[model samples]
Target: MSDRAAAFHALHRPGRPLLLPNAWDHASAAALAACGHSAIGTTSLGVAAASGKPDAAGATQDENRDLARRLRELPVLLTVDVEGGFSDDPAAVADYVAELAALGVVGVNLEDGRPDGSLAPTELAAAKIAAVKAAVPGLFVNARTDAWWLGVPEPRDEALRRARAYREAGADGLFVPGAPDDAVGLLAAQAGRPLNVLHRPGGPGLAELGRLGVARVSTGSLLFRAALGAALDVADAVRAGREADLPDVPAYGWVQELTERFRTDGHR
Candidate 1:
């Protein structure tokens, strides 16, 4: 396996989950890297919105690749969120993932959520995972099922069934984004791979998640949304003659230094 891929794989320790923060652009990713995060994943929503496209609508294919190419230059491991692999054809999905692998992306989150708020057929989703694994054996594939999020009947059963199929198809991780706290352990016990749950505000904390046997906790779009909220809050505070409640705000030069470092440190 590629060293980066191996490193990323090793981070998924059950009961000692890796807290992965997702980023939208280079600056956001760089800031997280500078803060000592060992790895970062892209948020599909942030990437799509930044380019004025709808996420998971089969758009943003080029945008996702371009961002991955730039983010690969950061001093951290990179995993890309490729919604439905940007295509329904398994071969096409594998091709996209292979291109990403060649660009130094060590991991990918491929979901089965359709644009109409429905889960893709289990067989089709599993086939895509199999094709991606076949094409890029070293890349860590995190197969996500949106059963819980889409309000499917017997969401846990649906999620577990898909998770098993994905695991058999060689997925390295299983992600159930909207899984509830009570169901975490049951899912983790049967996922047969790393269990990745999306972290939410007022939900189970990282420590609590870790205790529930989750191997990964992804801040899927949460960080990007929080950043947006902070920006607007600061702007509103300035207009209202009130001090912003923001904390850990980086200075201009510190931000500028990141780009310089990426350039001079052989990112290109």
Candidate 2:
């Protein structure tokens, strides 16, 4: 097994789903890495928002590539979310995956559903998966299905069908971001491949997911949104003069000092 791939796999404890926290930029990733996160992924939503582009629209290709380059030096394993491979062309998708793999990224998340609320053809998506495997060979492809997220009825059946296809097409794992709670565990069992899922705050806890045999649990954009929410909450609390519930935030100087330390130590 690839050290990177093996590192990611080792995170999948038998009774615990690997908690994959996603980061938006270098500072966010470096900070998370400093917290001892062994593996990290990127959220396309955060990346797209930071770059002022619409997510899952094939935009911000260069920006995402640049972020991968910046994260290449990090000590943790890195996974990038390449929305629909950033193009419908399988060759283009393979090229993009190759670029990321060259930067030491061990994994990539590729969605099959388009931004227009339509799903990419199964054959076409599978082709992209196969091409990525051929190009990188070691880049873990987490094939994501938007059957439920896109409002498709009969999500379970549809997700299973597409997931099986992706696995056969050489995807290392299957991600059903909006799969039903009842079906999520079932998918993990039936997929026969590693199940990488999005964690909803109020949804099944990680322990429940591990019991269900989920191999990986991703905080897909949840942490990013939570950060935004926390900022808003703190501002509102300050305006209301509620000093007690300020969330015990760290001082700016502390964050700044960490920045200096990061630079001085050159630790990724």
Report the number of the highest-TM-score candidate. 1
Each prediction's Cα lDDT score? 0.92, 0.86
Clashes of 2: 1
Output the worst ten-in-a-row residue range by lDDT, candidate 1.
259-268
Clashing pairs in 1: none
Say which candidate scores most in lDDT. 1
Assess the local accuracy of residue 60 in candidate 2 as a C-alpha lDDT between 0 and 100: 79
| Model 2 stretches with alpha carbons more than 4 Å out | 13-15, 239-244, 261-268
lDDT of 1 by residue, 88-185 (tens): 89999999999999999999999999999888999999999999999999999999999999999999999999998999999999999989889999
Question: RMSD of model 1, in Å?
Answer: 1.5
Compute the lDDT of residue 123 as modeled in candidate 2: 94
TM-score for each predicted model, relative to the true structure: 0.96, 0.92
Per-residue error for 260 in candidate 2, Å, reads 3.3
